[model samples]
Target: MDISPTLIGFIGFGILLVFLAFRMTIGYGMLALGFVGFLIVAGWNDALGLLQNVPFHTMFDYDMAILPLFVVMGFFCYYSGISEDLYYTVHRWIGQIRGGMAMATVGACAGFAAVSGSGMATAATMATVALPEMRKYGYADSLATGCIAAGGTIGSLIPPSIAMIIYCVITEQSVGTMFIAGFIPGIM
Candidate 1:
């Protein structure tokens, strides 16, 4: 009685789902199942070789470096309180203009986006920093929130962006070229 390759593949997939359902850590579960599948499909030597080399290739990639640096910068920005300063600075410069507070929200959001390079973080920071000022100025909630939301989304498309870094890595494109392509579109 021979088990077909498709049957083995389906069995492995089911086991992976069970591991996930049982709250096994995703990385470990995938690693375990992957080794088993590879061992079966190829051989023990090949499976072991794969396990040995994959992490080295994944870790040494230049694009992986960007994420950690940005993460560190994000923590620093959060603790050093730069986001607050950004909003206040924009507010002082634009507060007198009609709809200036909302404009400030967008401007500050874009500024913070440069530092955080994450849409969710930029939006969160802008909401915390700008919501009150916009409220105090009697700006409509929809307009104020909408501006921040739009501005925050630009973070992923702008330079020093995490998304673009990963994208360039996966696509084997030039990071500088990708950034240049995204920059003007992000700003506009």
Candidate 2:
């Protein structure tokens, strides 16, 4: 029996949902599902070829190099206390007024973003460095967490951003231009 491509797509999507529900990591699940789909749609040899080439190309891509470096830089910043120092410096500059701690969190996040370039890293780093200070000052939990979350998003817009690098690679855009363009909005 023959199956329409649309039906095959729906089946694949359903299987993906099942994989997700079963707590499989999305990356692995999608890779497995795509391999299976390729085996069905294109023969075994072609599917194997695709499996081999895709990973090779993805791993060797120049843009992909930046991701690991940024992550390591974030770790270095965290362990070396640079992120904490940034938070404290900003806090000192603005910690006198109401909601100042939250504002300082944002400023620190932006500074961290310049080095880290990943929102997750910025958020995690700031959570460790800023959360307790805000709590010590009697800031509400919701406000403190909200500010961190919002500030973390700045990493996606700042220079050296991993997200922008990935996007530039996929879209064939200039990474430097994208990073430069992100500065104004990222600061705001």
Candidate 3:
């Protein structure tokens, strides 16, 4: 029986929601659902062939290599105390003003983003470094977490951004140009 793509998509989305509601990791849920969907659509031989080839090609792709390097660099910065230094430097510069802590958080996040490139890494690192200070200063939980979350998103737009790298690779665009284009918007 032939199934329309729309129907399949709706069904898949419903299943994904159920998976999410069950607290399954979204990545694993999507991967499993996608594999099952592909297998159903393409039959076993093609599905198996896809599974075999995709990882090999993805692993060897030159642009893809940058992802791991960025992640490692983030770890290095975190461990070496660079991220803390950045936060403190920004905090010192602005910590006196009311709501200055939030501004400092954004500034630190921007600085870290210039190097880190991954939003998840930036958020995790900043949360570890900034959250405590915010709490100690009596900052509200929502404001503390919200600013960090907002700041972390800057990583995706700043230079060396992993998101930009992936986008450039997929679109056959110049990574350098995209990075340059992102700077003004990312900072603002």
Q: Pick by TM-score: which candidate is best?
A: 2
> What shift in Å separates residue 9 of candidate 1 from its native position after superposition?
8.8
Please write out the lDDT profile of model 2 over residues 1-188, one tens digit for every residue.
99988998899999999999999999999999999988988999999999989898989899988899999999999999999999999999998887788999999999998899999999999998889988998988999999999999988988989999999999999998998898888777
The per-residue C-alpha lDDT of model 2 at residue 34 equals: 96
Compared with the true structure, the alpha-carbon lDDT of candidate 1 equals: 0.85
RMSD of each: 3.7, 1.8, 2.5
lDDT of the candidates, in the order given: 0.85, 0.92, 0.93
Ordered by TM-score, highest first, the candidates read 2, 3, 1
On lDDT, the candidate that comes out on top is 3
Candidate 1 per-residue lDDT over residues 1-188, each given as its tens digit? 79998988799889999999999998899999999989977999999999999899989988887788886786688678898988899989997898788778888888888888888888987887787878887878888889889888889877778899888888899998988898887777
After superposition, candidate 2 runs with Cα above 4 Å error: 1-8
lDDT of 2 at 128: 89
Off by over 4 Å in 3: 15-32
Worst 10-residue lDDT window, candidate 2: 179-188
